[model samples]
Target: MPIAITGPNGLLGREVAKVFKKEYDVIELPHDILDITDLNQVREVLSNHMPTVLVNCAAYTAVDKAEEEPKKANLVNGLGVRNLALACRDLSIDLVHISTDYVFNGNTDTPWRIFDVRDPINAYGYSKYLGERYLETVNPKYFLVRTSWLFGIGGPNFVSTILRTATKQTELRVVNDQFGCPTYALDLACFLFKLVKTGAYGVYHVTNQGITNWYDFAKEILRQAGINIPVVAVSSDEYVRPAKRPKNSALDPFPLKETVGSLPPFWQDALSRFLSETQTKECLD
Candidate 1:
């Protein structure tokens, strides 16, 4: 059976398509081709493709912007997901929806579990939480995978941002207070492919095995690139944004491991591999 992938042009979706293409007949549907917000459009695509799996990688990811545009975020992240879930439920197809660690309030000192009571503080997080709830109630065959600090070749992520800034400045100041796992999109894509094949239909928190703050992540990026730039550690208050971020969003993939057998490697190892694969030369020019 074919697998329909929404947001096929996105960072994670692109990687997922690449891997899934090797095994299954992968259907790439972009927003321009099929806007998920429209219920009719979603049903049309589902009926046309008749895919066995629907992987939803599309979302309104602008965290700060969501604060001002909650409605827009809900329409895309919340309602869009609901549409897909309902369609899949009717068709009896498995729904693999990508989620985020922001679902947690970030106050917990320990890693969060799959069953953790989500109390998101930001608009983006709340929108995702709503999507999760909709999928849980609406679809029985669903894999709600929550990830964090994602960086890959396709998108403008934190790793790329740090590399860009480091090229211009000799020293950089990053937030040391906010903690989370840095997940490589390619790694996550591979894991998701394995997960769907296993028929594990439930919530899972998947990320690289360890945790680190943005400062540490930046330092590792520079080190991996063989750069000598000095990255300074600063508190989250030093660099304020319109939206509030969780102080700690690290999640435990123990349930995922127990169910899926294993997970991706540690963050540092994954970062090094990503840097090597992309060969992003830190250049100011």
Candidate 2:
């Protein structure tokens, strides 16, 4: 069986394609090659490939920028998803759709479950939530995987930002209020690959097994890199943005664990490994 991965050049998509290619006939498609907003394009690509599974990593993930460009975000995240879902249904293929933690309004302290009632607060969140519902109606056998705080080597992410800032600045002020699981993209890619090989189909909250605020996460990143910059904690109100973010987007890992028969490493461990790899890469470069 073959697997087609959209956004093959993205952070998670890159890792997903790299990991899954070892066992599956992988078809890599980036946005320019197959724009998700065009239904015919999506259908043509899927039909040509005739893949058994479609792992959709394509999304409009600009949190704050989405506020100004809601339609652009919706075009990619909402309508784009609907096109893929319909195409997947027509082809009798399983759809592995990547989602975000923004679907939930960050009011509760507890982790969000796979079956939680979604109440998105911002433009990006609403767009993703709309996409989720669209996929459900169009495809029954869909793996809706929700993850958060993703970072990897191939893209610009929070971890890279913090590390870069810490290396130059004396004091780094980070938002302490918002909290969620810091998932490494490669680990998420592995979990997504695992899901496709199994018969289980539905929603899965796949993330690293722990949660921490951004401030602490930044502090830890600097600590591991042996950078001695001081991390200052600031509230959400202090650092306002156009899009409202969930204070807590931590996902429950129990369901994915039971489904996959294993769980990913903790956020701390993943962070350590990522830093070590980055350091090794920099030394070589």
Candidate 3:
């Protein structure tokens, strides 16, 4: 049986498709190609391919924008996932859904555990939580992987944002209050490929190790890219947004150590690898 991946053009999905295709016959499904929100489309596509595993990297990830358009977010993240779950169940295909650490309220200081009660403080998180609920209840064979602060080559991410911003400005102000671990998309993809093959069938927290807030993360990105500039760390209150971010949404690696045998490399190491791969000179221009 072969593996199929949704959102093959996305940051994580691109890597997931690349990783799986190296080992198994892979089907690539982008949003335009397969709209998960439409039940008829999902069922028809799945039925036609009949892939053994379906990795859902597609989601409505507009954090602040979701506040204004909660319905759009829910339609894609919540009801859309429900449609995929229902189809996967009928087709007997294993579903692997990508989630965010924002699912937690971010009230606690420590790392959020696997089974921590989900209390999303933002619309985006709540939408993803809805998807999780649908996936858990609807499908027996499912992998719910919650990750955070993703940075990769294909997508517009924080790393790219900081790099692009630094070129125009001498000093950068970043929020220091919120905290979470950064995850390399390729690393996450490799792990997911290994995970589905295991048939663990449960929740897992996957991210590069270590915790840091936005300000510090930005500083590290510049440092890695050999960019020298003044980075001023500011509190969340100083740099407010439309959505409310968790104070500390760091996820704890529980059974990842047991199931995957090890966690992904540290955030700094992953950042170094990303820098090495990316065109730092072009980012500055």
Tens digit per residue, CA lDDT, model 2, 12-81: 9989999999999999988778999999998998899899999998988889999999999998999999
Q: Give the residue spans of candidate 2 off by over 4 A.
A: none
What is the C-alpha lDDT profile of model 3 across 1-285, one tens digit per residue?
Answer: 688888899888888988998889999988888999999999999999999999999988889999999999999999999999999999999999999999999999899999999999999999999999999989889999999999998898999999999999989999999999999998999899889878899999999999999999999999988899999989888998999999999999898979978889999999998887787745776
Return the lDDT, model 1, position 185: 95
Candidate 3, superposed: residue stretches over 4 Å from native: 280-285
Name the TM-score of candidate 2: 0.98
Cα-lDDT of candidate 2: 0.91
Model 1 per-residue lDDT tens digits across residues 33-83: 889999999998899889999899999999999999999999999999999
Which candidate achieves the best TM-score against the true structure? 2
Reference-based TM-score of each model: 0.97, 0.98, 0.97
Rank candidates, lDDT, best first.
3, 1, 2
Best by lDDT: 3
Q: What lDDT is reached at residue 131 by model 3?
A: 96
Candidate 3 backbone collisions, by pair: none
Model 1 misplacement above 4 A: 280-285
Error of 1 at 178 (Å): 0.7
